[model samples]
Target chain A: MISSIGILTSWLLFLLLALVFITNNLLKINIYVRLIVFLNVCLFLLLEIGLFFDDFTVSYISNYSASTTPPLYKFASLWGALDGSILLWNLTLSLFMYFYLKNFKINTSNVDIKIYSSILFFFVGYTIFSSSPFAGCIEANEIGCNLSTLLPFQDLVSSQIGRGPNPLLQNHPLMAIHPPFLYIGYVGMSAPFVASVSRLVLKETSSEWVNVAQKLTFIPWLFLTIGISLGAVWSYEVLGWGGYWAWDPVENVSFIPWLLSTAFLHSAKVTKHNNSLLNWNYVLVGLMFLSTLFGTFITRSGVLISVHAFSNGTIGTYLLIGMLIFSLLFLYIGSINRRYFISSEKLKNKFGRSGFFIANNILLFSSAIVVFIGTIYPLFYETIFSRQITIGRNYFDVLVGPILLLLIFLMIFSIKLSIKNINLKKLYEDNIIFINSSLLISIIFLMLFNRSFNLVVTISISFILISLITLNIIKNFNKKGNSSYWAGQIAHLGLGVLAIGIILNFTQSFSQEIEINSFDNFIFSENNYQIYDIVQENLPEKTELKLPISNGKITKFTSLNIFNNSSQQAISSPAIFRNLIKDSYISIKSINNNTFKLIVRENFGISIIWIGLFITSTSFLPKLKLRK
Target chain B: MKSKKFSLILIIILIFLSFYKISNESRFEKWSKILLCPVCQGEVIYDSPSEYASDMKDILQEQIKTGYTDEQIYNFWVTRYGERIVTDNIARNFEIILIPIAIISIFIIIFLRKINAKK
Candidate 1:
């Protein structure tokens, strides 16, 4: 019965969205938007209710939730799978549209509503047709049927049991919150996309759209940063890999859009200030939105192998076709409206602030292109050469590394330069003290502690960046107002800190495999580690092995969980002991009759990365509040 | 003028320092990163905790101990498990390297031309 209600609500939402495009004149757009939002809320609530009640009659609940499942897992199971995540996606899109329309004055001729509603219409229609969570399942099948398969209501009634959530997802609490933040970040790009498209289509030449686009991009960019950071934290704490980012295809897809949105944010600032890079802003915003769609395509489609991808399906082909159609439509509109993209004022000085912004955009955009190609190259290579090849961390480190270095350089100098003036002499004089001090510190530090050439370069660059940004902040400390300037500087300082952490962690981290008997002590890297106890806990559906290890100062517990489900999967959760300078990470590789093999790694400067990410993400809060 | 000269001298010193190359990774660390875990999805042998990855690491260590060259060890893996086993193929492929360089250079040229055109 609840499954039927879900399907009906989705269909109602789809029809209401379609009415915005079909019957444009019959009802007000606000009425249609209201109906769509209401139906989306209803659909979302219906799924939540189904999961909460353990309604085995609904296939989604039966597949993901069991009677013994915790209430939190049951709630998170709504977005734990492919079909339900799309439902969450639709609900997020509707909420964004409802709130945006409430604040902005969108007119009848404004293609913003139409474009926005059409995106909603496409997702709602996709939920109904391609992958509906409301589909029923059969009980007798040994393995559960494909999730997207729609069965009769009579068949679902026969199934009274559920398989429970994906053991990997329910293993940690981070899984529940990570996907929501990421989805909000992904769906939030549609706002600027719709605004950019409508602005191009209507040929509006005012700078008002720039403000709207910047504000829209800034909020999503903050969420994307937080989401990606949380995902890294989850990967480190949960995956037992002793590392955060793996350059996996899914991670790259999400990061690709972020790179574009960040570039757009920078270029949009230039356009607002100097009325330049107008055309670039439009294209960047458009790409930012489309890349989100492409990200969804890569995640849902089984073409690329990713640790984070859902099960393979035909939904990928449909999403690709949809992406192609949208790209073509955007190209069509952009080409016909090319003349309006031309800015009245050209960049007059190569050494001015706008010049640095332009260079920053180039480097960022090129890095995005490099990542996008590296991600999809294997698919192309497989098709043509009939061989499978993996593009891993080495590929990105080589190609995108130099570009990032150049961007960091630009970030430091761009702050000191004026918008329209070219004054290298005065700039040098102003920053000479900072430059000398940073160079001196870098030289001394490298002489004392550097292990490799890369470490030396990274240490030197970070010192320069941090010192320069601090110099800026100190110079501007007593001056009132310009909170935006302070925010940007703080964000840059955070990036510097994050860069230092990443490089230090990468260079200095070492792991060793050691076999230790119970209650035995081992020595690694001059730190003595002793295993205190190994405790096994029996839960309703799983067995967990918790190992407590101490390094004479602190004890941390690392665990391995073996699920009692049909798949019988096992996941190991690493324990990290963090301090002001570094983190001591330990994970269980395997266990044999009271003997445990542990991978103990000393991760240097990891705490600094989290602190940096915190400072950077919160810097946007003041800017966001000022937007209001 | 003094600050400009100091900056130029500093740049030269930095450039000269960057050319001093040293090997930071051991043979085991390097080879473990280049080879993928046969059973895991896109994970290197060094990072994966699976039985197969551990076995691969053992074989690699044995090869290194037997006085095998890097090329000989890499070839042994390629023969055993095709070209897909190597995780650094994109870095080794010369044709793929040119594309990104060309794209970045083109962007730089366009940006420089736009700025120069104004003057």
Candidate 2:
């Protein structure tokens, strides 16, 4: 009877599946899919509302929620734990599945919709059977099951009172926005997977699916980009470090699918324009879905050690088996229908714009493969030689750095290159002015600063790219360009600015850890910083360090707040002085009365990276208008 | 023909410079990046904020000042801790290095073959 909630959830999914089958095989009405989707959404919302209300009879509510928690965190607790996260994933999938079904009903067959329905049902079923949030409690005591039973009860009396979400999850508001956006992006992959599978089932090789796949891929891709960026911002702010990206396995797993989908989006266009690379596009789409599942498996399996990994459980094995089955099914379908997907058409100019796109795909896909292998290599090594080894930032930097530079190089050339012809004369005439200006600017930049050759080259490349994109955008707008064209140009411009910001940050950011007592003075990066005051507050039960930093002309006062919690370790909030060119940040490592160790860092050009992200995400808004 | 030759020469120079720049980074920088932070999960010594990571950085800097080779410094860490103390050298990670190269090579071959196919 305790499992009744999961059982009831599964039964609802089953009924929805039955209705979909009936709609496909017998009724032929589109409204049934809509009805099922609406019902599923309502069920999920009701369960979450029950959680918000602290309905401790439900096992999940008792596990992640408490009566004393704030309303907002109580709502976020739905995704703070593993089981509820899966339910949220299922809900997001149904939402997207509903829209996808509505959009494609007129264009695609009922069988295609049924296949989509089946995919949604399988996920919902997986959640109910393997990792359901709706399991019920036996006793339903007032304080709920002592979920803190697993932890060493330092204060057993307080532990029995109440509990809250995971400390890291509750620390920041971004947790609410970040995980759901990521899940929505991950679950949105079902659309393209359904489209790709439906095409294979229908035995059609035309470019129809390419169009649908391309359009649908962008929706998830945009959400994924925002999710990744927000995740980076969260880490930068909350992880107590100034660095945003650490190239961790969890980060790499999420990134790999974005890379694959980017390749697929580019190649889908090639498949349409050149009538080539059809098989490549299909393979990329399949890989995108596979990467999502693989990422989910890694996060849930707990085979790897990561700060971002979810709680370990048997659900991982279920996800792994599901991944293997889907991968094998794709392989079988690919091998059997390989020839139909292949095309005999060739590129008009083998080394033209289309060629650049192909090169882009190669670079992206190869880097994705590198990241995937790097992520799994530790597991493989552990299984084989019984050794644990981690591939860190250096491995990724060594491989991906050059590939990214090459991508930028290709992007610069390809944008100006002709699509179907090798017009050397025209190309030269068009680019000679831009090339000369770029060189002049590079020379001036080198003269202005004493820097390494690599830094100079990178800056010059980014400058040239920015200038080129600006010129192109101006020309296009003068011609009364369409929104799609502007979107591409704006997005590319954002990448140019972002690359410059990243390069500058990597080369120039510096940090120093210093032990300080009260009234200690330290000079760093041409600034003198003095610990002016230390205040301890009682009501908030926090310590605040006041440090005044001065560079003769500009003086800034920054405070680092330290909060002590009885149940968990003390948490420190770093103080940051944000500037357009640089961010001066200080974090406290440990504090005792007047003496503490402080980490001071000067982060250069990070603001530009944030600005670039904003511009790039905004570029997609034009696409919505274009769709109309 | 002259412009083509000039562009080709420019590209070769660019390639050589980039290759040289990557290989010739300062020894202190390379050594600090090579070690793993003892207390942090999967973070390199240079990026982690742990006291152990700070101590490792001090050891690396001292060794570099004493004119120790990168290998000798790496051996110092490995001798004290296990081989897990340092970031896995891709140079020594045969399986890890081989699989990625093979995968990329195969994909490139397939990609080239597709592009070169006749209508």
Top TM-score hit: 1
For residues A68-183, what per-residue lDDT tens digits would candidate 1 score against the true structure?
67788889999999888988899899988987777654464647788888888888777788768887654423323333335334445425457888887888899899989989
- Report chain B TM per candidate: 0.73, 0.66
- DockQ (Cα-based) per candidate? 0.41, 0.33
What ranges in model 1 sit over 4 Å off?
A: A23-27, A139-155, A158-160, A474-483, A566-569, A624-628, B1-24, B110-119
Which model scores highest in DockQ?
Answer: 1
Summarize candidate 2's per-residue lDDT along A352-449 as a digit string, tens digits: 76777888999999999889988888888789888667687767877887787777766676456557655757765676667656645655554433
Task: Tally clashing residue pairs in candidate 2.
Answer: 0
User: How much RMSD separates candidate 1 from the native structure?
Assistant: 2.7
Q: How large is the interface RMSD of each prediction?
A: 4.1, 5.1
lDDT of 1 at A200: 68
